[model samples]
Target: MKNITPLQVAILVALATAMLVAGSAHALALAQSRVIMLSLITGISVLAMVYYAINYFIYRKIKLIYKTIRSTKTLGGGEEVYSMNEDPIGQVYDEVQQWSKEQTSKKEEADQLEKYRKEFLGNVSHELKTPIFNIQGYIHTLLDGAMEDPETNLNFLKKAARSADRMEALVKDLLTISELESGSVKMDWENFDLQELLQDVFDSVDHKARQRGIQIQVKAGCRAPFMVRADRKKIRQVLVNLLSNSIHYGNDHGLTQVGVYDMDRHFLIEISDNGLGIEAEHLPRLFERFYRVDKGRSRSEGGTGLGLAIVKHMLEVHGHTIHVRSSAGVGSTFGFTLDKANG
Candidate 1:
């Protein structure tokens, strides 16, 4: 009865009322019953027709409205609208409320994405502008009388070349990130000695470390060669970027060390520096592009501010993640893990 339609209930009420009227009139008198009976039959017939026509029109309109609402739900990518047993109007109200909430959530997410997009564009522009402006200044000075002065001519040319190189590095890093995000970078996987790779990186950056009196060495237990499977070129880039940061950010005569740990099927690698450590607040955002704890010092060290960002992406491509632990004045450690080569 609870699931019965409004039209069914209306028909039931009309029939019950007609039966009561006929029963009461027949009890009044049996002599005039024939005349009353004829009139009663005619009235009942007319009432039945009127009730049927009215209910037919109302039910048809209600069904059409339900179908329209169902079609709307389908277009909105909602679940299949089921046949309503009780009240379709109430169900429609509930669905509309749910859709409104979902739309509000989507709007918030879109707003956040738009904000990030704008921030990224601004950062890129600032990074490129510095080098471009420096190059223009150097060229203009050289063109003005410095070109005729032998002492300043070669110096200005070198400075201009360096600025151009910085711009080139920035562009290259940007391209690499774009390729990585677009899934266009192909990994060249191979089994290689992790210890040997560290040595190569150390040798590559030895001169730079020496200029600042920094000592870079592997931790004692990690000196042994540990084989891992990964893209050799990308891993090399990761190592270079991490080591370069340590060298650039370390204090004079500071120590930078890398440690290795065996974690069953994986190897954990940590690059640590006892220099100008990062504050705890900055650790979460360390991998964001162009995010610098010390912007002036970072720029002075000739970095494109994309090294750590690239490092994070490269590791992610290999199904890995990088983490950082740091304190303001004590030290900083960056760690990542790679799969061990199968026997």
Candidate 2:
């Protein structure tokens, strides 16, 4: 329709048939010139009929598909231009199938995200409700003539204060995660002695570990300092969070150990403890916000339930990752990586 007419296309097809037969005869060395002439004439006649049938029936449908795809999709230069000389029907079919799969995959991911969002909101509300109710009850009791009794008043006030503190911790953790996700908190990167930092964290929590009769130490071979580049404060937070969690769950007279292993370009830090380990099923979602393996026990532990989530975010900001492993009665191990420091 644009440049070449249907008559011209038929003429070209006829000429191509003649040339093809002539070339075949020459290549075969058959020396059958009359045979070549008859073949060309018959081939052209058959080709004309076939071409008319295709153009009138099949070509219209194929061209329609091509046009529909063109109209719907923004075809960049990578897309082949539609032409009668080429069959693009197969390519179109494959592309359409692939597009359908991609859309389906996107929908699945969207549904998953939506589900997570609902769970997060519900978790936040549920977490806040307990402390809020406790505080409300304590204050109401104090106001209802318990204020006259110094013993009851003082005890209720202290309980109310603890509840308020729990709410404060929850809110702070929520802010920290929000800040981390929004990239509002910047990592201050530098080289630091990894072993030295671990000592500081242990000393800070020495009393808590002592109460459990649990000993905290670096693995035997990992006492020496491993220089690494990362945000010092954030890494320390990661250490404290993981180590404290280990101590809280550790068995009496058990051990919690930190290990640093040499990876080619990074150091892997693992915190392992002989504690009440998590179930296998909870491992996958252990890092998720407010996802507790033992919800009742976890709430009693006075944690905002965001420690692991915060640790994950802190390490991730330094382009690193953290992982955990556990067995029912054996122990749990958490591992993470950091870039090696330059000399």
Candidate 3:
């Protein structure tokens, strides 16, 4: 039975009473000649009152059920009333139960994610601290040796110099990654020639490529002066990092290719190398900070493990994306997009 409010019940009661009085008055107008009609009118009014009272009791019960379902507090202090076996109220209770369960699950997941984030920060701190301490120790050794032995002092000084340079590189890469991540590093967006940029990057790494016997090939579909809107300095850094990585890991007699595709909306630059390619499992996490597939080899090569991470962040800030395609023994390609000049 649907619940009726107190006001509605009162209204129905008054309507019934008015009908009974009117019937009685008609009977009185016909007087003694209509005694049977008067008796019938009184009986009908009694029956109507009985019906209203029964409905009122049922309505009150239904209303009580509704109040119970809507109440947030439990019947005891801690037990929610999820259902009552009857109409409207039972459905509401079921919905509340489902919502409560969902909330509980989400809260648990949030707690777990927070825990993982903390662990990641701890790991990063440890990684950074080791390099810093090594650099500090090397400097102390160099300074202390100057008073004891002249030849040893010079050797220590060179070692200390190398350590300092490594530390500087690490710190620089860290700053670049932080700025890229925080979105504080703004690009100088202007029209520049893609071919010129490629030539410059190639020339910068020419000596290294020559020493390693690596050949670099450049292919451009765009005209000599293909213009793009991007930060020239950051883009140069990205190219240097990618190209150096390729050179560092390339196979003997391998070749590196630099290609540019100028679409109407954007410019695509791809750097590819026939190197010892990355494994399948490590591909997805390649952009993660300080992630290395070959940690020992990377350390030996003086890699800070933040190069690709920096590349990813910088490209993202420029409203671009980078993607990699590789086969374990074949080769790898690193590609990124740059916005085309407006006019």
Candidate 4:
């Protein structure tokens, strides 16, 4: 019943015609041979006409519909591109329904992606505009009457320089992230002491942390050499970004801690800070490029806004994931895993 064929329809119609022809001849008392001959000829002729007409018109149209529906994906390959015995009309209905669903899902995803792209572009424009405007205004003032005032001229020049520096940092971070996403940046992997790297990062960021009197510490017993296999330079960059983040948002005279733990096959490195942490809603998008919290002067304090994003990508390329835990007013911890060095 689900698979009624045109040929089956023709056979059923022919059988009914045969019975009708035989009954009419017998009612008129025609000869037995004449009745049988008439019935056979009528049945065969009807069968041929019906089968031929259906194939020529209805069946051909059905085939065209099925082809049109699948032509987009025909060259893509499938296990059974053609089914010989299936009902053509039923197949077309199923294909159309499935295609409709696929199109709907694809459109939804594209729309979401488009929305995200627009928002990202807007953020980039806003981030660059402030510094660019500041630099322009400062230069214009210095070129005008401010140049005659030595005291004011130097201050304007310094402000212009800072704005220019910010622009440069933003451009550099953008380029780094693009390269990381396009897979053009390769990791130079090596075995190194993770604790040693931590200390180095601490020393590097000491000058910045000192501005706020923040203490950067390694957790007790974690200062020892816990060797790890990773891109030492990239890992250093990650630690510096996280540590610097803590400093930017941490309370005056607050504390930042770095810890290392053994996770059987990998080492878990975490950076924790007693800072105004992110809210639950923002946590999901915290690592996104150009995403900023309302309270932090991340950009004003030399942040490029792409720090966390770059860190995420750098870890991802090494077959690892970064995790963060934070809430408003409380502290936050950012952790990522690295393969432990083989003994």
lDDT for every model? Answer: 0.84, 0.85, 0.76, 0.86
lDDT (Cα, tens digit) per residue for candidate 3, span 39-61: 55655665566556744675456
Please write out the lDDT profile of model 1 over residues 201-242, one tens digit for every residue.
999999999999999999987888999999989999999999
339 in model 4: Cα distance from truth in Å? 1.1
Question: Candidate 3, which segments miss by more than 4 Å at Cα?
Answer: 1-116, 140-147, 220-223
lDDT of 2 by residue, 156-218 (tens): 999999999999999988998999999888778899999889989999999999998999988
The TM-scores, one per candidate, come to 0.82, 0.76, 0.69, 0.90
The superposed Cα distance between candidate 1 and the true structure at residue 72, in angstroms, equals: 7.9
lDDT, residue 260, model 2: 94
Candidate 3's clash total is 0
Superposition TM-score, candidate 4 onto the true structure: 0.90
Model 1 segments more than 4 A misplaced = 1-84
Clashing pairs in 4: none
Q: TM-score winner between 1 and 4, please give it.
A: 4
Q: Give the TM-score of candidate 2.
A: 0.76
- Across 96-120, the per-residue lDDT of candidate 4 in tens digits comes to 7888888888889999999988988
Pairs in steric clash, model 1: none
